[model samples]
Target: MNLTQNRTRIIEVLIGILATQLIVFGLAIYMFNEPTRIVEAQGEILNVQLDDAMTLYAQNCSVCHGLAGEGIGATPALDSDALRTMDYNDLEKVIARGRFNTAMPAWSKEDGGPLSDYQISELVALIQSGDWIETQDRVVNLGLAPLIPFTTDPNPALLAEIGNLPDGATLQAAVQLFAANCVACHGADGLGTGIAPAVNDPLVREKTADELNRTVTLGSPGTLMAGWANVLTTEDINALVTLIQRWDEVPAGILPAPNVPIPVTEESLALGGQLFSQNCSRCHGPEGQGTQRAPALNVKSFLTDTSDLAIQQIVTQGVPGTAMPAWGDRMTESDIQAIVGFVRQWEPTAPEVATPTRGGGGGPPWLRNNTTTTQGTGQQSTTGQGQGQGQGQGQGQAAQTTTQPNWWEIIDWRILLLAIGALSIAFTLIFMGVESLKARARPAPTEDKSQE
Candidate 1:
């Protein structure tokens, strides 16, 4: 009897140990898969970041930098092998605090720019990866027009036969050619850029027609200027030489403005319009006309000067020391992009809007005294502590923003279900083990003694 009881107890203990081991095995499996899971999650996040960076690049940086980071006339290429292999920290710093005397503006908010640290990081990642084809495709998919089409020297083989033309027509052709090809390195009207010499200068004017022709035919050595001999015909070269020698003959505003129409789709316009009305109309008016609260967005000057990216930045990161509030937290990147598209539609024919007259209000809306004015009657007004109220409300909003749950914080139902199943199996095994022990512990029934 003692031996049987001992055996039963040992069996029960083994059952309990087996149940515990099952749980341990499940945990071990989970841990084994964790690295793969992390890798997959990271890859997904990188894809999202890259897509966003592409849009950012198209809207903001592509004007100077080519669509595929091929680099404009003077701008350095971001997709080059050198940039791809550059140290991560060095790239990040360059983006955060831009190079001095360079067109690359400091993009980080710490340096008084529109982008946040995370955004700067995304851009850096984009540059280092040097994968711009996918980026370009996405920009196209979004119906965002590249600010400027990439321009190259016109190929002579591709040119139409140059027939003898009147002096005026020849000069006009030369102007068009120069504007298209030379204007990139040499600034508009041959005024020149840092990389290229000024063609409109006195040195060129002093040169004989033959010298001008030779210089244009054979490019200046050890300089960015490449000879147009292979690209332009003799007639074209002669026309250019005449134009350069008599630069004064060209009228003002002859060069075509490098403005391309924003590529907005009907679908995009409809969606953008709907979103704009819902979110932006209250302050910016239905047609982006100036309101008592906000400046008119549909003005010629604003549309003409502000690039789509600039407008996007302004929308995402609100103007400080003003009534405009940052919508980065409240809106998705696509939503902001749509708003930019909608706003950009007004650029072609936008008219000047008169500025709204400011009431006798001092400082920004938040900084000014909070006043409650009664409707009609005597128009009685009362003042309250604006700063304190504003601060409190700001703090509350900040708290809400900070408290938003992270992706990892949310429970996965699959994991929960698995855990529950493991626990149920463990408990069932434990219960079965206890029942076997109880059965083993029960006293064997004494043989019947009725016959004795």
Candidate 2:
């Protein structure tokens, strides 16, 4: 019995020691991973912010700033090293309040613009990251065309001749500026439209720089030509004047193509859903249910009355004097078509949305999983073996796939540690109880007194 008891005590001590080692190992792992986990969490948060900021940029800033923050026309590039290294507060303030007497509008809600303080902060962080390539990638994935970089160099002789220009203004700058702001009304190459006279005409070329500048700055009364004095800087006016005076010298400017009907396909619809969520969802709502900012596009009335072409037109040209800004410059014609197609899909069984609600509630931007939600059915169907085949509820189609979650990824380490500790204790107690029962069942070992 003494021998048996000694053996049992040894086994219990070994088990206890094993349990302690396991607990120590778990603690070590937790301690080592805590900093890593914090970093991962922070990275995930930044990624979400970046995604939101990317969408906001594509919708609001990309029109003038360019898709990759490479700058368009007179708009300054945000992808510069200087900008990335700029003070956060200064950058945030600039984004919120905008620059004085420039095209940059005050974006903060406090300043009567669309974005909130939190949104601006996200944008600031995104800009500071200098991840324009990622931004461009996301934009392209959303079906928008990538911004074409200007590879054409300006003639130095023309630069010398055109004095009193903006600090960084060049002949190329004039061409880009014209293409961006002038193409709609003035026609390509200043060919003129019914509403506006041709600035590239020989008669106009005969005018002096000062004369052209005056005409550009001040409005032609009772004419469609509005004064740009309030809108454009004096230097910008000079660049336009120079272009008009030297039209033959200026290189041919390419304008955005007119909208063409895009054939609706599953692929296009999927792409369209993504585009709408990224670009239109903030105002139009995720399901197009409308919000305080924009009207519900998924309603029976709106969808029925509005043709696909009409929707495309509205999306392209945008409604003037309202919150809508023209997307023709920012988005490709095909991209607009896809969005229109997606909107048109709702017409078949469009629901009447009487009340407007706040948009955006699918899941955390970083928590993308292969989970598809069937439309009109409260069923979730996951397709494909990997993570790419899921139809995200409000996220449209999945753009990319993620790795499958491992056991470690799925479980909370702390809980697992607690469970391990509890099991160890329970196991010890159970083993001791079993041993006690066996000891109780065994008759007391009687001392054999045969030798005595």
Candidate 3:
């Protein structure tokens, strides 16, 4: 009777211990499940906010600043270290007020611009994300900067011509003045660098001497160009103008142009497409949609503002103070004309829309016909495998395969580790409980009277 009572007591104790463990396991599961709900809710809110911010940036900021805040033409990169380290309040202030004497216009509605305070805040958040830093690092590692140096010393003969001028006078002192003041932006050779446009461009040469003098004296109001009136004398200004005019005399080979005009034709367009793909697609995007490095060619505003002659000149001479490189020496006039013709095809007044698809194809139009063949082959392979197995066995195998969880589908390492740890703990607890029960069920040691 006592032995039976002991067994009953042991069974009750095991049951109680198991109940406690089950309660603890239930509590842990509840706690883990609750936090996931909270986290999911938070994630949804954050995703919505981020999406709105991205849309706003695309609409308003992506033109000159680039779709990814990479700068193009005269614009400075917004993703640079300067912007990354800027304080939120300062960034907001700049966005709202706009910089004085620069191309950046006030964005705040209070300043007669389009954006609200909230929109500006969103933009600030996007800028602060520093997502472009990795891309910039990669670009630097690749050495994407032009190999040809833009800045070089002025010709000795040109320098000698101004020797007779007075000290500190603009013409006589042009080289020294430019070296000190302009070299930072314009490069030593007057080829445009990242900071400034090339002064040696033919478009610049078209400016009258007086217009050039005024520009030098007063500075361009909405640009980085600062007036030198306060620093240089009137004679210095005249000398500088004369020096700039000398660029007009530079030979066509030095700044090449088309010796003969190529007429627009279907053949020209095909050649142009090939040339643009090879030479222009890197900066301009494959579809001329524009990138962080170049402005969109297909946009209505660009087409309206630019003339064919202007485009030709730009292609031949290149823009100064920007990344545009002169292709005159590198490409023939016919080749350049072909590219120009291809670019012109996008210049129609109507808004450019994507070509509509004829049917509901998952891939590109060219690959639509192959979809049926791919599906048919996959079905045939599945049928062949099924025929090789018995019906019952095949069904059982299919059930097992369907029910089995693929470990590779688990992307988060933390979740996987947690699951493994819980399983181990459960197994250990069960093994310990079973060992305890077994020890209790074993016969007690009998006294050894013979040995005593």
Query: Stretches of candidate 1 above 4 Å error?
Result: 110-112, 141-143, 147-253, 257-452
Q: Candidate 2 — worst ten consecutive residues by lDDT sum?
A: 377-386
Residue 54 of model 1: what lDDT?
69
Per-residue lDDT of model 2, residues 1-452, tens digit only = 77567656866786777678677767866875776566566666666677678766755565457767888667799898898899999999998877766556677777656678998998998898736766664443343332222222334454454444443345557766776566544655575532246777889899999888877776454333545766788887887888888776643433322333334545456656776776887887677777889988877888767666568768988999999889876865556765777777767656654345654565222222112231231111111111122222333112112212333663576557667776776777677677666655553444334334
Global Cα lDDT for candidate 2: 0.62
Q: By TM-score, is 1 or 3 better? A: 1
Name the Cα RMSD for model 1: 15.7
CA error at residue 282 for candidate 2, angstroms: 36
For each candidate, the alpha-carbon lDDT, in order, equals: 0.60, 0.62, 0.55
Candidate 3, residues 334-441, lDDT tens digits: the string is: 456557766777665324433222332232222111111222111111111111211111222323343334544533654555576577557656765776676565
Candidate 1, residues 1-452, lDDT tens digits: the string is 67667667777776777667687767755765675567566665666666567656654566567757878777788888888898999999998766754445566767645677897788888898636765554343343334434343433322222222246667667876786666655554576532356788888799999988987776554333445666678998998998898776655345423444444544445556666766776777666655788887777898888877567668878999998988866765445665677788766656665444344223222211111221121100000101011111122243333334554554476456567667767776776667676665554442234334
* Candidate 2 lDDT for residue 396: 16
**Model 2 pairs whose backbones collide:** none
